[model samples]
Target: MECKATWRRWLLAALMAVSIVSYARPPASAGSDIADAAQAIHTHAGAHRLILLGELHGTREIPELVRLLATRYAAQGPVLLALEMPHREQASLNAYLSSNGDAHARATLRARALWQRADTDHDGRRSEEMLELIEAMRVLRGQGRDVAMLAYDTAADAPRNDANARDRFMAEVVRAAHGALPRGRLLVLGGNVHAMLERPGYAPPQMPVPMGAYLRDLQPVSVRIGAAAGEFWACRQPRPCGALAVDGSPGHTGPQPMPYTFGVMLERMSVARLIGRADDAENRRAVGP
Candidate 1:
């Protein structure tokens, strides 16, 4: 049964299980890359007048990038920092900032809201790690930019099993929010998973097809930023990583090259595992002593 709840409310509910650090991007540095990313995004915003910079959820550099851009873009107009975190965190989010407490506490309260309010199915239960991203969202919101949750989440029980639901959900938010945002620019922070073209493996094969192809169809302009080629892992774990290391986890890492699709990489991993299992039953065998 498809969830009867509205899309915005559903997004808030289902988003509770999200974790920011799982993708594990490298740390960003204080200079160069951060400035470059900021400058690039800034330039894009200035030129296109609207650009959504897709980011890995919980990447350490993302906050800094957001911090830089939010402040830089502050004068651009109402800079709506659209977060994938839930709406339940709003009150606590504001409180944490108002308390003038430390980063840990602020992060804690934000997570608490996500865990408590992730009952997207209206089942009256929270989700695991929903708080982490919520904490990140809180961090971004505390910055005092004109932020809002895009609320482009589909219900857990949606009729469509694919990410198109998510894409359409986001598109609707952009369209609706765009209506009131004159001279306003939207900066979406979300998992690249939902930002790509939903296909057979990544998305359910049976979902309704949209007119145009790819998630890019939903947005007019997008800018993907990260480390240069063969240098994504510039930072290491256990702190003191990257240019934007507030608490030391390296910034963006991986395939090294920026402007590539990590989401697609994840899908590739899924495919590889699937193929491995199909080719060799022993690979799928249960682990044993």
Candidate 2:
């Protein structure tokens, strides 16, 4: 009886050890994965001064990836992080980055029209994750890192339906930013289509020229984000904008080659939190009757 009890105690201890190891392994594995992905990004950034990351707008992963890359690049030298937001928001973005990332500064940034867009038009760019990314840049700058951000999209009042004109305008904005920071590295984040080096044969007539095509002379390394299956926020016209389901190797068009210089495959993706809605809810909760 004494021997049996001792054996049972040993077995229980081994089971608890296994349980502890299993629980601890996932977080470490996740960190490893992120580190590997960052290394891949670093390799690409090393070869090209301008790294264009074309991503699906509404995933939490891409923003985190951008933050990691920005942090790494800032350590080496000056770095510019450009986003697809309207140029009119540049003042607001600059102010937020310059200020202490406090509640008031966050509120001011959220007050912009981009974050308060109608639910039907909130296509994921104004995500909480993106806001967090901006905050991360602020933190980096506060830590004395030479980091800057640019809102390089077309102006809000510009003709929204003119794809080519919009791309040209965006490219010009990026060019000016690059010229201003000749020694600084730039990481331009935009929708996947805008990062294509050439217009795909299957592309619609509206986008005969992509922004990447316009900036090809700079030898920008364009990377397309890929996923096996996941959800992203997008509008399918006729359907309201919301989290949409994606399946079976999203972003891969077989036989016909894509214009991206390289690709980064994410294990899976999840929808990013909408910043406006979340902030509104938090405020309401704070002021409850």
Model 2 lDDT per residue over 229-251, tens place: 78888776789888877554334
Ten contiguous residues with the weakest lDDT in model 1:
264-273
When summed lDDT is taken over every stretch of 10 residues in candidate 2, the lowest stretch is: 17-26
Estimate the lDDT of model 1.
0.40
Report residue 197 deviation for candidate 2 (angstroms). Answer: 0.7
Error (Å) of candidate 1 at residue 143 is: 8.8
Using lDDT as the measure, the top candidate is: 2
Candidate 1 lDDT over 87-132, as tens digits, reads 3344454454334345455445634524332112111112112223
lDDT agreement of model 2 with the native? 0.71
**TM-score of each candidate structure, all chains considered together:** 0.50, 0.81
Q: What ranges in model 1 sit over 4 Å off?
A: 1-29, 87-108, 111-151, 155-163, 196-219, 229-289
Off by over 4 Å in 2: 1-31, 247-258, 277-289
